[model samples]
Target: KKRGVQTGLIRTLESALVWVFEQFPGTEAALNDLLTQESGPESLLIGKGSEAEMARALG
Candidate 1:
């Protein structure tokens, strides 16, 4: 069960990355900027609860 949860998390993260790349063109630079500014993985994970914040962050 733990392994399954880990696999699911990986898949979800992969999908989130794809979505970000597709939704926001030229995000590579923005991503670099965001990374240089923050220290946590929370900035990368786009959960349903954080949809609005994610949009704002990407913007």
Candidate 2:
């Protein structure tokens, strides 16, 4: 949603995440870590023209 790509189906996404966590148990922890590692909410002010923001967001 942040990058403005069109997407939907929340239940399917949730099921896919469950499948991923089941298939690779370690993946859930890494994803949890990413979710928890928050410095600030710079995403609210980001502009699409800058690739650096995208790179940082991905990292």
- Candidate number with greatest TM-score: 2
Task: Please report, in order, the local distance difference test score of every candidate based on alpha carbons.
Answer: 0.68, 0.60
* CA shift of 11, model 1, Å: 2.4
Candidate 1 TM-score over all chains jointly: 0.45
Q: Model 1 clash pairs?
A: none
Model 2 ranges with Cα > 4 A deviation = 1-8, 40-59
Q: Compute each candidate's TM-score over C-alphas.
A: 0.45, 0.51
lDDT of 2 by residue, 1-59 (tens): 26753477777889998997888757777655545657333433455337755444444
> How many clashes (backbone N, Cα, C below 3 Å) per candidate?
0, 0
Q: Per-residue lDDT tens digits of candidate 1, residues 4-55?
A: 4654788899899888788879776666676676555564654534666755
lDDT of 2: 0.60
